[model samples]
Target: MSERETWASRAGFILAAVGSAVGLGNIWQFPFKTAQFGGASFLIVYLVAALGIGLPAILAEFIIGRKANLNTIDAFEKLGHKNWRIVGALGLFTGFWILSYYSVVGGWVLRYLGGSVTGAYFGAPAEYFGQISAGMDALVLHAVFMALVVGIVAAGIEDGIEKATKLMVPSIVVILGALAVFAFTLPGASAGYAYFLSPDFDALAANFTDIVPFAVGQAFFSLSIGMGAMITYASYIDGDQSLFGDGITIVFLNSFVGVLAGLVVLPLLFAQGIDPNTSGAGAVFISVAGAFGSLPAGQLIGVVFFGVVLIAALSSAISLLEVVVSWVIDNYDVSRPQVAVTLGGIIFLLGVPSAIDTAWLGWFDTLAYKFFLPVGVLGILIFVAWVYGAPAIDELMKGSGLGDGVGITWLWLARTLVIVAVVVTLALGLQTLFLGANPAIIPPL
Candidate 1:
């Protein structure tokens, strides 16, 4: 066996992790969710859930990965709890499941990027979206998008994934910041800001049940929690880096990007007289495309906006693909390139149904968000809090600049509040799934 690859630098690892967290979950889904829920009310709940539950859960996975220095499933077994490998398996499966449909959306971003260049979608934004959203065009674009992901993963971590994200993440931030500045100058921008920033305590209190689940789901999804991507990334750490510090940084950057996305998306929609409250999976593409079409310098702005989204999509896709690829290379004798191509092809084929028809995509996404993600999160919390026990804290404390006191607090929180919160969220998600409840309340992350 050969030595495992490590991140080229701390900055590289941080960028890759942030790239994974700040994908379509932020740019595409966050805006619509804010519109569908009570805007700032939803934002407030999401921030709480992210810090309260998402951060600790992320540290748990980081501990498991860095301690074992192996792939997700092997990490557990290497830690002397072979039975707990099931949790890692769930995470691996969830990542794979998500990417299948997720690549389909990535395809849409790529198509829109090109359409923006030619002003193709500007004439009739909705019709254009309808034409390209499914059928052969979508399937072909899905393959193209997956190919880009495979090529990068095959190049090895430091040279490919790290290098790509170092550029992509920064570009996402700079472009988004500029777009937000532009959005603020629009005439009706105040209404969008009001919708996103102004809180309605009454609605939040009354619709707590309906709102909280989606907020929790958004936190998990946006942070790339409950997927094995973070675990896989952590396995590449070369030293006793501060896992706590890194986790905090990732959460803050990810949350900032999500909020920044809202700043650009909502204002643009309101400026063009498009309803920001439009719901469903197509909300971002259809509504935002219409807004871009009607704006001055619309085509140029559309090109830049969709280009940023395409970069975000690819960055996240690389992490999801890496989770599966890392596991295979750890266990099998195959080379990284071979594994990437074979698995990428299989994933592409799996996504075909979704590419052909978006209803299938919705089903795949719903299953992942509602069932798979929460279960993966719950399993990791149990393992870290119970099975790994005290040593989990010991691993988290290396170079973390903290004493035993903080570690114990994190452990107990994981054992009690985090676990219970996950259980409640999972129960609510399951109820919505099985009882044919209103899905708009628990939109797919």
Candidate 2:
């Protein structure tokens, strides 16, 4: 067995986990997805999924990873039946798929970061976005992003990963906080709030089946669940930490960031006199960029917004890279440099179509989010709920302030509500992705 090294401190572990959670999903995808789904109603469902389903499941994975002190496959072998080991491997595979497309998106954000500084889209935002949103140019940016990700992972986990996340994640939080506050004070801010918060419970109830799966997918996305990123990152953790406490905190912060993003994007879009809904899933990027471009100090704020996203993205990408890197080094005894090249090369090839084509990019995004991720998370929830049972109680109880009492209650939740929610969400995600959004069945928007 290799020697285990914990997070150098508790703050380091908390920040890293939160860093993973607060990526493109929360900061980039959440606002846009919410706007598409009827604003605050989507947020309400997302909250329920996060606390009821996401937190408990995350705690379960962290327990297994930390207790076993290894990557997901070995972690399962330590906790449950020999058959269970493949569950973690599936998670690892999902993480690779996620990073492949994720780097493509991250590269776009990096390009926008540079674009923001130069007022690249100042006059005609839509045309500029159309030009770079896909094609060979996007693929080149994707390669650059992939190379940067490969370089970070090549430097090893503790030193390269931790140091960068430590510096970057906090800046993301701070800038987002300030931006949210600033947006809130803009004229017509109440309209933005109303756009986001004034829920049509009828729309929600009518679209419950439709929305619930998205919420669950969003839950997986926001909490960084299912992909073995959590499990792999937790494997590096020392024994002194509380999985439940950290799990709750990471979920809280990530959800908050998502909400904050809605606040920042909605009000600013309304204030800029652009239809907030027009940008669709690309709303946050375009609306915010357009908003910044119109402001008194527009260029500076544009730089800040885009720069912050770039930092947040890289922090998340590093974790995805680590999961693949760990699998290679642990299973094959591969050198760090070679593993980086091997895994990076495979992802680069798999992601090329996504980088070069908008349709392929959308396909990867929808398939991974609405299909791959939920299925991956569903497997985790089921495995934890039934397979591990008593051992899960013991693992959760470890370093838990409440011990068996808290563990037993959560175990019951894990068995009942968590499993049901994940299954339902996974089913919904599959339906939506394959069948398309049947508005007649969903609701008359």
Candidate 3:
């Protein structure tokens, strides 16, 4: 077999990881979820869940990847726990399942970007979204988006995934930051800020059960924790970099983007008196499109905003594609380009149902996020804290500039709090799914 490829630098690895984390989940879904759940109350719980549960899960994946220096499934076998490969396989499957519908959403973002250029959606934002959100237009756009992702992954690690993300991640940050500043300048922006930044404890207390599951799910989704994206990316590391430091950096940057997205999206919505909570699946597209249409030079702003989303979507898509591509090339004697195209074609075909009907897309997304993600995360934590045992801690502390003490604390936390929290969240998610108790928390299509 050919030698394993490694990241060109520490920065490349971190940026690529961040690029995976900072996707449409953070920007597209977050604001709408916050609006629907409890505004800032949901945001507060999400932050707590992100740090408490999401961070340690990220470390667990990092340890697995850096130690094995192999694909996610092989990492388990390499570490002498062949049966535990099931955990990695679950993660790999989750990423694949997610990308099937995720590509459809990416296509919607691309359509909006073009519509912005021609002022197409400006006339009737909701109608425009209705027209293009699914069917043949969406299918074609999904093909285009998948093609871009395939080309990037086909280029291999250093040249394709890493190089593309370095540009995409930074562009996401810069453009979103500028948009956030502009969003704040709009009329009635203060209400959006208050809704986003000020938590309603009473509301949070009342909706504690309803809110926490979604918060935990959002944290996992936004941080790319449950999927093997982080694990695959970490496997490419060439040095004994601080996994904790890198994890922290990835979380911080990703959270920053999530918050910035809320700032830009909510303010834009409120400034135009659009109610985001009722906007359903097309919340971002419809509400933000209306907001832009009503604003001076709104078309230009729409172009730039959707452009950032397109880049973010591609960055995440490439990482998900790489999770599968990495596995194929590792096990078989196939070339990267061949695996990329073949897998990309298959994934595109898988997404066709979602492209043809958004209800199918919602079902795919809900299944992955509500069931697959938490299960994948729980499996990894159990493997790391129990199966891998002490070596997991040692892997974390390798170049982390920390001693054994920190590693032990993290391990115990993973064993107790993280695992328990995930279990509770998973139970709640399952209850919601089976009982249909609270359908609102089910992600919008």
- List per-prediction Cα lDDT, in the order shown: 0.91, 0.79, 0.90
TM-score of 3: 0.98
Give TM per candidate: 0.97, 0.94, 0.98
291: Cα error in model 1, Å:
0.4
Q: Output the better candidate (1/3) by lDDT.
A: 1
| Candidate 2 residue lDDT tens string, 100-209 | 87888887887788888788988777777777767777788888988888887787766778777889888988898898888887887788889898998999998887
Write the residue-wise lDDT of candidate 1 on 1-445 in tens digits: 5569999999999999999999999998789888888889999999998999999999998999899999988999999999998899999989898899899999999999999989999889889989999999999999999999999999999999999999999999999999999999999999889989999999999877767778888888888888899999999999999999999999999999999999999988888888877766788899999998888899999999999999999899999999999999899888999999999999999999989988888788777777889899999999999878999989999998999899999999999999999999888777777775555333343
Arrange candidates by lDDT, highest first: which order? 1, 3, 2
Give the range where candidate 2 is weakest over 10 consecutive residues by summed lDDT.
436-445
What is the per-residue lDDT of model 3 for residues 180-296, given as tens digits with 9 covering 90 to 100?
999989889898999999999999999887788788888988888778998999999988989999999998898999999999998888888988776356777888899999988
CA RMSD per model (angstroms): 2.1, 3.2, 1.8
Please rank every candidate by TM-score, starting with the best. Answer: 3, 1, 2
Higher-ranked by TM-score: 1 or 2: 1
The ten-residue window of minimal lDDT in model 3 covers 436-445
**What lDDT does candidate 1 reach at residue 43?**
95
